[model samples]
Target: MKVAVLASGRGSNLQAMIAEWQEGTLPVEFVGVGSNNLDAMALTIAEKAGIPVRAFPRDNYNDKSEQETDILNWLEDIGTELLILAGYMLVLSPRFVRTAEYPIVNIHPALLPSFPGLHAQKQALDYGVKVSGCTVHYVDEGMDSGPIILQETVPVFDEDDEETLSARILKKEHIIYPEAIRLLANGKVKRDGRRVIIQRDS
Candidate 1:
């Protein structure tokens, strides 16, 4: 499978995926990495890996649609088969989501449904939830509201803050994001409505 990544910040998850791919643990080829921020560390990581990188900074475009159009075109050019979103901050426009040729997946910092959108860790902490975790799911028009592919939970201590909770969830994100991609690459993922079924090896 030919994969591409979209990230906006540190790209820790991208780094994790790259490490697995380099180790031959993940069966996929990274075709490109795209970022909305010109200085995103994800771009640098891609460059270091010798993968193609592109930036579609909103400031350079007249509108969000124009920027997304360019991104879509870039993905088309790269022949991307799977799109993984790692810490990508932009909420994809419905048109873009509908138009993309391949399936798009994202790793979220919370278990989802309960805490979708931005600052999910903070939301969980503020709500005083006893457990918090990460989720890898398909990207739909709604914010973090898509068919879940995988999820792993971690305990939330009374003393935990947003940063601390986020750190814990991030660890799980690194582990599961690559695993989800592996499943996709191996044709082990099946979607049935809002649920994702993972096929076991015979």
Candidate 2:
């Protein structure tokens, strides 16, 4: 499957996905990388992988909808079938959402429906939790409330600060995100209402 990744940061997750692609573990191609911020490092990462890249000026764009339209057209040009939001921060307008019949996945730093949005690792630490994890799920209108495809947990250590906890969860994220892609590419996940049924592989 062809995949487009959107991100606004360093894109450690993007590196993991691209690495999987290079190693032939993921039956996917990096179609393009779109970033709301011009300075987003994902653009550089994608270029390193010889993936096409696009960046837009957030303040100068007419509106998010117009920019998203342009992005969709660009992806369509490349035959991108799946959208993988590694670290894209924008809420996708319904324009794109309505037409994304294929997969649009996002990886979150903490177990979703728990520590969603920013600073997820800190959210877990502040809540005094003993365990935290990462989740790969479909991207719906909700913040992180999509059908979960996969998750992996890490023990929140007693000495853990925000950085320490995030470091731990990120390690697991590297594993599950690629696994989620494998499942999706292999047709092992089907959405039924709000649930993602992990289909039995024949």
Candidate 3:
């Protein structure tokens, strides 16, 4: 699959994706990195890896349709078949969600339906949960609410703080994000409604 990654901050997950692609562990191509923040480390990493990038503010579009159209045009220019949200903070315009004509995937720092949205790791820590993890899911119009792709759990140790728990979960993110991409690339995932069924790799 040809992919364009969108991110809002320093992209550790994006780095993992790029590394996996380079090692040929993930059979995919990342066409570019797009970010709402021009100074995002995601863009810098992409450039260092010799990947193309685009950075534009969500506020630049006066209307949602215009934003969607512009994004679509860019994706077409890059011939991208997948849109991956790797720490991308912007809520997607519904038009972009509906018109991508391919898969849109997102990586969330917590096992979703438990903790979602911003500062998810903090939320989990504050709740004193015994387990915390990461989720990979399809991006729908809603915020952090979408069809699940895959998940891996990490224990929240009794002595763990938010940053520590986040660090542990992020390690799992590095594993599952690339694995999810590989699953899709290899045609092992089938979507039905808000659920994704993964066919066992033979």
Candidate 4:
């Protein structure tokens, strides 16, 4: 499988995926990394790995449609079969999501349907949930409302703050995000309605 990653800000999840790729665990060739921020650390990580990287500034485009077009064109040029959003900050336009050639995967810090958007850790803390975790899911029009692929929970300690809680959940995120990729690569993921079934290889 040919893959591409889209990330904004520091790409801790991207680094985790790279670790999996280096260990020969994830069965895919990364075609490139794309970012909306010109100075995104994900671009730097890709450069360090010698993978092609591109930054598409939304500011340069007059409208979201143009920006989406540029991104689609870039993905097409590289023949990307899978798109992974690892800590990518921007919400993809509905048109972009609908026009994707293949599945798009995303990792969220907190168990989805609970904390669906930004500041997920804070959301968990504010909600006073005894348990918080991470989720890897397919991207759809709804925010983090897509079919889930994998999830791992972490207990919330009494003394835990947002940062501490986030760190713990992030550990789980690193593990399951790559595992999701592995499942996708091996033809194990099946979606029926809103549910995702992962059939183990026989």
The most accurate candidate by TM-score is 1
- What would the per-residue lDDT of candidate 2 be over residues 12-111, giving only the tens digit for each residue? 9999988988999999877889898899999999999999999866776688888888777877888888988888888887668776666688998998
Q: Clashing pairs in model 2?
A: none
How do the predictions measure up, each by TM-score? 0.98, 0.93, 0.93, 0.97
Candidate 4, residue 57: Cα displacement in angstroms equals: 1.4
Which tens-of-lDDT digit does each residue in 42-138 have in candidate 1? 9999999999999999999999999999999999999999999998999999999999989999988998888998899999988889998999999
Tens-digit lDDT track for model 4 on 83-163? 999878889988999999889999988888898898999999998999999999999999889999999999998899999
Q: What is every candidate's alpha-carbon RMSD to the true fold?
A: 0.8, 1.6, 1.7, 1.1
Candidate number with the higher lDDT (1 or 2): 1
By lDDT, rank the candidates, best first: 1, 4, 3, 2
lDDT of 3: 0.88
Candidate 2 has a TM-score of: 0.93
CA lDDT of 113 in candidate 4? 84
Displacement of the residue 129 alpha carbon in candidate 4, Å: 0.7
Of the two candidates 1 and 2, the one with more favorable TM-score, higher being better, is: 1
Where does candidate 3 have its weakest 10-residue lDDT segment?
63-72
Ranking by TM-score: 1, 4, 2, 3
| Local distance difference test values of all predictions, in order | 0.94, 0.86, 0.88, 0.92
- Once fitted onto the true fold, the runs of candidate 2 whose alpha carbons sit more than 4 angstroms away are 200-202
